[model samples]
Target: MTIDALRHSPEQLRARIAAELERARNRSTGLTDAVDGDDLVRQHSPLMSPLVWDYAHIGSQEELWLVRDVGGREPVRPDIDNIYDAFQTKRADRPSLPMLNPDEARVYVSTVRDKALDVLEHTPLEGRRLVEAGFAFGMIVQHEQQHVETMLATHQLRQGPAVLDAPAPPPGAPAAETEVYVPGGMFLMGTDLDPWALDNERPAHAVGVEPYWIDTDPVTNAQYAQFIADGGYADRRWWTPEGWAHRSNAELTAPQFWHDDGTRTRFGHVEPIPPDEPVQHVCWYEADAYARWAGKRLPTEAEWEMAARYDPESGRSLRYPWGDEDPTDEHANLGGRYLQPAPVGAFPKGTSPLGVRGLVGDVWEWTSSDFTPYPGFAMFPYPEYSEVFFGPDYKILRGGSWAADPAAVRATFRNWDYPIRRQIFSGFRCARDV
Candidate 1:
């Protein structure tokens, strides 16, 4: 049964929504203060919008979904809706749009949030998709949190001194050298009942996966460094034709945010890479080439899920690697607690039933799967969320990153990006034929 099946009371749902929104607001505010106004509006990279745009966009979406859709109220500022519509404008063009300035963005979001909470107080927890078990509220919280993560990425890409700070993660236990074996079987994948689950993650279905050997932990910086040291980027034989073209055109020598001189940047802070940490900011092309260099392959989304959520003895899947309990610091390094990836295997409590480590909350692991829908998939709330993004044009990334909100991190959560983009905190582990 899904968590929503528990029949949360309207009050309970209100509290949950309030708490999640507060967390998201706090994170966004923190990110906003990390840089000056110029940084907030400047497009740090072509891949993402300026920080101020994200700030206003968060409010715009919340207003669109919660204040207007759920509450049946007129928009607070309908004129700005198209301006903040992510689909209407490209990232490069967003800065030039009439986006609300940082101060106006903050005020707008705060005003909308207060009005949304008032609506939440009167709305039933069940009914339409927007209100059912507080799904729309949950969706808004997730959306805002997602923007916080994106803004954090922008901060990482910004050229400046360190602005964000967090305590370093404690060292991890040594991971077992042997690959974890996922026995071949038909395992149920995706979520049929997770009320907050997106359209792409619906209608759990059986997937027949062959037995395979997967790395016990994510590939580390040291391991990837070895690939680079061996001239992996220069070797075309290891790369797919498209991957080589991307690499050749971009002249990428290392993961994004890394220089040829053996140092990496995190949250705008430059330093030598922690060799044991899981590699971050790697594009699918780079990850695929590294897998080829190591005589392994990026795990298919099925294989990755099978390793992460399937329990052979129970013949059932779990809500997370460590079961249905909500994630904690001991389970994973998430919610921007450390602003950087923990060392691989740091969260032993987060291990999957198959003994795979760091399966969630470190860095998003690239899977060799296109962003496609399941057999019975149907768009809910809106088509723009996931339906439009489905196809071969995007690659899937499973497992949330360190900046990911706990509420947003789930065994079936799906994140997608273009194969050539690398600014996000993305990494990969390898799987091989048993």
Candidate 2:
């Protein structure tokens, strides 16, 4: 939908935002607050805001926009320009700022809430739409969601949750080749807003693709073993010139974590050799090699999204393959509480309507598309958000890793990394034509 139809009157916006703000405040929100009345100097995390910072930051945001811009009141804190701009922050040198104290911060958020409500009570209701107000308020909530995870990530080195774990490999199953299905069709891609999507996702255009088959899941260790055994790495014929050059330069023969059977897995114990656990830590070169050795190819972001929609059992868009609920301990290998990859086909209930499972939570799936914005992408006002990574090289990955915050694993959240280096967490699925 267009932005014009989305904007709301100031009063209606306030009431809608108030409900969301309360919901977020009640939740742990990824940012833990100090015990009430405790005299600790640091009331909240600088990595995440303290209780005061979050409340004030959110409130200041309302004040800047609603009171000052919309309602025309002078700003309570004109310095908001220093902290809030999402796009600008990324481009500057403020990553180390010791921000506002808890008390002052909360005052800001609370003040905004109070003033926002007061203004809304007298606002006109005739032409205001909840949709626009919802989107705006939702943006604020989503911004909070980001901090919630950021706070978790910054604390990962401390008492934060451990990395995600996978299920043990199936016993005695020979390593299998993976494939990608090439769906040749005029598929609808990108959101069409005049200022709707980020710059890259925009130019809302359609691409004609050829139909093909892709692997249902990412290539696992069992599959990689066969590639090595079949001399996939030793031969240069299977590699592209650039791919071969990279391989030679790195002096690499096998996947990054490949050692003699008992390596410490992302899961708790040493591997007795779980072959079905999706192979982790391989770079784009390795994934491409595996695809080449198997006579298939990697799917583009569009293709990957389309295949992710495939459900052999049902025909609907489910939030997760397991269904529309947030992941639980028994669902896909998430929260890293398991500490490693699960065997393929482990979560039956998590399968999508088309029988495609693990699309939402698992090792992030790499796609052929470079990490670029969609049509109509508007930078989130944070300079470092989108412009820093528009180069042609960075690859796009979907889904969230086991250790990634569950909130980060939404169907649309994209991840990217360079092609030559494979971290312990990266992996991929393949695609081919029928």
Candidate 3:
């Protein structure tokens, strides 16, 4: 089913929601089931919560929004609410908390799903802000899918043999051009019409971007390797003061999981780094440095959005790079269809009107922008989701990763992380002013 299927008739929308919920749950369970109970409870990395926390946390949120708030039903398991509250507890401290055991977490989430499904059946699809067009349900589905992606990242960090498996992504024809030119003009930056879009992506506003050139496809591993080969890490000239400081302190010679033998570990398997594939696990600092080394700069958030969504011919922003239609396998490498990013230019059909490719998926692209709210931004449902993170402390990443779920990702969707963080599946393309 399409991600925008939520806008259909009540009957079709119900079925679509149910299918998406099931799809997300299957992913959550599949990842958790691959390892033993011990693995689920143990924190794989301080950067991520235990897999079990995510499991129950998914259900806790579903129950809070769907069962209690939407349905006006009694809580399924109020005792564990604090345990899974992300804001109340941080990732590093979660493993120490009284979180539910693996078996208990499974049972709790299952129980909550049953109640949430019942609420879905009875809840009206109109009137209220949250329920209108089943926004609440869509939000829950996206929430669960987001956690599922997080679990996938945790799996990548866990020690041992590869427990996950997926076919490699399709190869791509070499791009005829390295960079696509975007004309300077005004285009709607965000979305006010998209019902399921998070609050941060709402209230679409006009943004005037300067004409610039963006890489047609994400920067490849070979390109980044060249940066490293040229003493990019040792040279401070290519890096910002902050980036150089972090690089020195961390002794980051290459992207995370990369080894000296010209190979990288992916999902516990060591393989030669594919020169054609987009580089992943690099932080904002690394991407920025690489851009500087190449005599380019990371695209600003507005520039990135313009490249991904603005249709100069139509003078309107499309929902995705390809068009307003929801993403399909042919559109991008999304929904964990492949465990790793496709080769750059693999999804030609996903290319934007301006000939930019790989904007929807593969790896989250770091943009040279702070994680700030749009003009006239307002928090919805809660403040912790977006409002609290607004500032220069976090750098924004555009485009979704291969690990991202389609329902949770869009051209306007904004993801932010600390500049020093390298755990996320992130890559970047260079841009230069015309």
Q: How far is 410's C-alpha from truth in model 1 (Å)?
A: 0.4
Instruction: Please report, in order, the local distance difference test score of every candidate based on alpha carbons.
Output: 0.88, 0.56, 0.92
Model 1 Cα lDDT, one tens digit per residue, 353-418: 889999899899999999998999988878998999899999999999998998788999999999
Give the poorly placed runs of model 3, Cα more than 4 Å off: 1-7
**Better model by lDDT: candidate 2 vs candidate 3:** 3
What is the full ranking by lDDT, best candidate first? 3, 1, 2
The order by descending TM-score is 3, 1, 2
lDDT of 1 at 341: 91
Candidate 2: segments with Cα more than 4 A from true spot: 1-183, 190-207, 265-273, 310-331
Please report the candidate that would top TM-score against the real structure.
Answer: 3
Task: Return the clash pairs for model 1, or none.
Answer: none
- RMSD for all candidates, in order, please: 1.4, 7.5, 1.1
TM-scores of the models, in the order given: 0.98, 0.61, 0.98
Error in Å for residue 260 of model 2? 2.9
